[model samples]
Target: MSKLPLEGYRVLEWGLWIAAPTASMMLGDLGADVIKIEHRVTGDPSRGLDAGYGSKTGRQSLYEGFNRNKRGITLDLSKPQAKTVISKLVQTADVFITNFRQSVADRSGLDYETLSKINPKLIYAVITGYGSKGPEADIRAFDGLAQGRSALAMQAIPEGPVWVRPALGDTVAGINAAFGIVTALLVRQRDGKGQKVETSLLSSLMFQQTSNLALHFIGSIPVAPIPRTRPTNVMLNMYRCADGKWINLYMPEADRFWPNFCKAMGIEHLRDDPRFKDIWVRAQNSEALVSVLDPIFASKPRHEWIRILKEHGCVIDIINDYADLPGDPQVIANNYLPEFDHPNYGRIKYPPMPVEFSATPGQLRRPAPEFGQHTEEVLLEVGFSWEEIAAFKEQKVI
Candidate 1:
């Protein structure tokens, strides 16, 4: 019922895959009019990507997930006629977002320098793989590559680095870019001046691990990869139960919950034991403590342990798999995974905007547009005549 936070803003997105589109998608979710520009012929490459969840209907979950709440248009930017269209769109856009490499952007005249010259007040957001000014600035990068370069992949066990799935680097970079764009919008509102905003998957990945990476940066220590079975804190680790289901505990203030935790586990005699008397001692003797707790946890099913621990006010939770999310009560109550009847995919769910605003809540007004679904409408909004639109279409420019 309330107007959304980003109402009255216009965003022009020239992106593919996840990062740049994701930024625009968030802006769209917040009520901005986001026009997603794609290649005239092929559209977004992700549209065809199967992602292992592909259906006989040829729907792409990846593209669908990232591109909702936006209008779609196509433009062959290489064509000179397309430049005229882009210039018109830029003049009316409050923000312009792209994740193209530097050379690609320059060649297509979508770089900040060129676009800003067209509209002096345009907030240009650039998402890159490395950064805008580094040695690898022009290098092409994807989620896996950025994660590997950012040392996130190396945080795995001694067996080797693990590749995280579902595009962690890209998603984080996109979220960071959206945050930067909103901050820039505030500055623009204050001074009526727009500037270039930049973020990279590498930088975002590093930011994600700031607390862990701080040890290496501040103490000048080479951080070793985490070992699978070696936990720094016994109380802050996961245990397998009698049913083979895993449950994780998080009593960081172990001393405060020591007696209650012991009572819940029916091991109150061990509460006063010197070897596990406090957080520090438990951490120091974590291996020994794990040995003591493992068999006890294995004595009960996950549900029983969960009930007992929660009854005793111990911080605990079950490790849910992907299939558990759709039915999760907390997830449903918070609307983290909202459902909609997609035209091609039938009934499905996608993640919505994570933050909630009491006064100005966001909404999913529409699904991601079909390829070039709004080209004519968007062109008319930007001041192109119907004749020009038809001519551009005849010339394969839109």
Candidate 2:
């Protein structure tokens, strides 16, 4: 294997929770050397986040999940001595990422204008709740608030508005921030100039819903919550099997797959029925068609239906829960979830970088660091002597 795509890059991250840290983690996964900075005393608040939902893991899982492939250091940014360390790091960093509000960044001298002076080629990325400018820019927000404000919550559940679990908004914003940072890095490579790159939870989530939002924008159709029971396309809906399991069909091209699908369900006569002849007519009579098809699907167990549909080349599969993912053959073949030997947790598995490269593949080289684990080591690399490090520690500035 060749060197990873970002092997020579250096990233400095001042992030909390998920967004900015997740962005830096992506860069680190591609082989950048990421340095995570935290408050000397409290560290990232996510270190204490509970897994909840009856998960067996403790609070450390959240922190470990977002912070792997990075070095950890602590510093009191408010302290005067801490400025020296930051300035030195900025001078050598190729990228700087922060999820701090504008005011907080300005106060800590971590703003783009200040850091760009230290390293003109630095790619500075910032993540926010709303945006850098606006009345609500500085207002604190988390995943749920972003989902509600961005209208994602409205589309999440059929009955009423409800935020999606597992921090959809934060994760999207983080991925967007990473893309922006990588784009900026490419631009810097061309022009030898650094620039500020910004992303927000609201903007990311809005972009995620672009196709649905365009219905209202261009077609005069109002975007609304999708009803699972009454699907507009009967061929593209889910049905319950005789064994009380669910199977989903995704035959979007109704005309192309009509014969095969009908043949698979032992309802080949429906293929010529006028009310369900074409895509449009089938959609118009979807409820009646669903009524006709649901019983046929429910006549067999999920595995039996899966086999029959697959044999006929109808696009169908059994619906899987989270527990089904680990042993999934396709997932294992693609290495989507890779196992790692963690010092504290023993054998564990987590989702790796999503993309694969033929020549420069990514690797998970290290686990998340312990609190301030590499403070002295990082300081030494930045030209700080043992005496200075001790003094900084003595003054609570490390």
Q: After superposition, how far is residue 245 of candidate 2 from its true place, in Å?
A: 3.0
230: Cα error in model 1, Å: 2.2
lDDT of 2 at 62: 85
The C-alpha local distance difference test score for the whole of candidate 2 amounts to 0.90
lDDT of 1 by residue, 1-398 (tens): 78899999999999999999899999999999999999999999998887455456677777888999999999999899999999999999999999999899999999999999999999999999999886888999999999899998888676778888879999999999999999999999999999999999999999998977898999787777644256766777899999998999987777788899999988888887898887777767778878888899999999999999999999999998888887888998898898888877787888868878899988888888999999999999989999999999999998
| Runs of candidate 1 exceeding 4 Å displacement | 51-55, 220-225, 272-281
Candidate 1 at 129: error in angstroms?
A: 0.8
Task: State each candidate's clash count.
Answer: 0, 1
Every candidate's CA RMSD? 2.0, 1.9
lDDT of 2 by residue, 38-77 (tens): 9999999998766544565654888889999999999999
Clash pairs, candidate 2, are: 74-398
